[model samples]
Target: MQLPLPPSPMALPLSGRFPAPFLPPSMRKAGLLHPIASASLSPTIKDETIDWVEATSNFFEKDTRPIMLFDGVCNLCNGGVRFVRANDRNRRIRLEALQSDAGKKLLRRSGRAPDDISSVVLVEKDRSYIKSEAVLRIMEYLELPFPQLALFLQFVPLFVRNIVYDNIADNRYTLFGRSESCEI
Candidate 1:
């Protein structure tokens, strides 16, 4: 008899890699294992405003600088973090690897799965941004020219910017490679 081939990582759903309990509650509700939704609010949240300060009161009480959560083992992500650290001379931004305890805590507090590392996450005092929005927001802390460029890019349609962001994110590991461990 021939041995059966194991399913590839891509073939497995997000829930397959993690136990049901580890998956987010929303994913568990429908018994579905899909990618995590955008870091923004869900469609059903149209009316009520979330008082994030009260929700995450203890977490952000002391430090209000934006915190960037990035993939620890991704070379491109690590390089991006390094770039921000070097350019943000005023210490305007804070950094954390998604795999860290602090990062996981923030992810949970932000209503994201602890294992969700598909996109960069930026947590400001009152709100959080992800993917392209996070990247552009982070740019505001960089040196002059980049900040100016970021302001200009703000006019671009979110869908258009996210299209570019998604393409790059999808190909990041293949294009920029992965690291054995987080550099910073």
Candidate 2:
């Protein structure tokens, strides 16, 4: 649901080893896209469109921290969050249950349906990725050998990756077993 808006004036430069560009124009225009931005921004939808920068810039000003939003009640998702928390050695990642207020707000800001909880979302500076894209983004940030694997997977077509991701998501609850509470 991300808007196809024109580029902004203050777009930031992309960085890091992850091939993904920093603040792609789409993300930059949509707002909520800064490497060190805040995730507390709340966007208002109006006239069948969002105010974009006005609604997002206030919340993400100077903060580009990535927000990881996952399905709260899904055991598989919870485990994934736990794994991220434990292995993100520098504590570079921030997490939220998709059912939480913050997470919903982020989803909306990213122009995604807030109710769609099947996908894991990675909110990076100026861009948001879901499903297989989100997975690859997370993997790209991981330490060493894993990043290598992510790089290898990047060569596959996106549709193929999404199909694989969809299969796993479709059966994760049955395979992993859901818990009464999301403990991640």
Whose TM-score is greatest here?
A: 2
Report the backbone clash tally of model 2.
Answer: 7
Once superposed on the true structure, which residue ranges of model 1 sit more than 4 Å away at CA? Answer: 1-58
TM-score for model 1? 0.69
lDDT of 1 by residue, 1-184 (tens): 3333433321122221221123445666986543332223344332234542355556567877878999999999999988998899999998999999888766655555667888898877656677877888899889988889999998998789889999999999999999999877
Q: In model 2, which range of ten residues has the least summed lDDT?
A: 9-18
Candidate 1: residue 142 lDDT (0-100): 90
lDDT tens per residue, model 2, 115-170: 76878888776777888878888877766776788889989988898898999999
- What lDDT would candidate 1 get against the real structure? 0.71
CA displacement after TM-score superposition, residue 76 of candidate 1 (Å): 0.3
lDDT (C-alpha) at residue 24 in model 2: 62
Clashing pairs in 2: 33-126, 34-64, 35-64, 36-63, 36-64, 37-63, 37-64
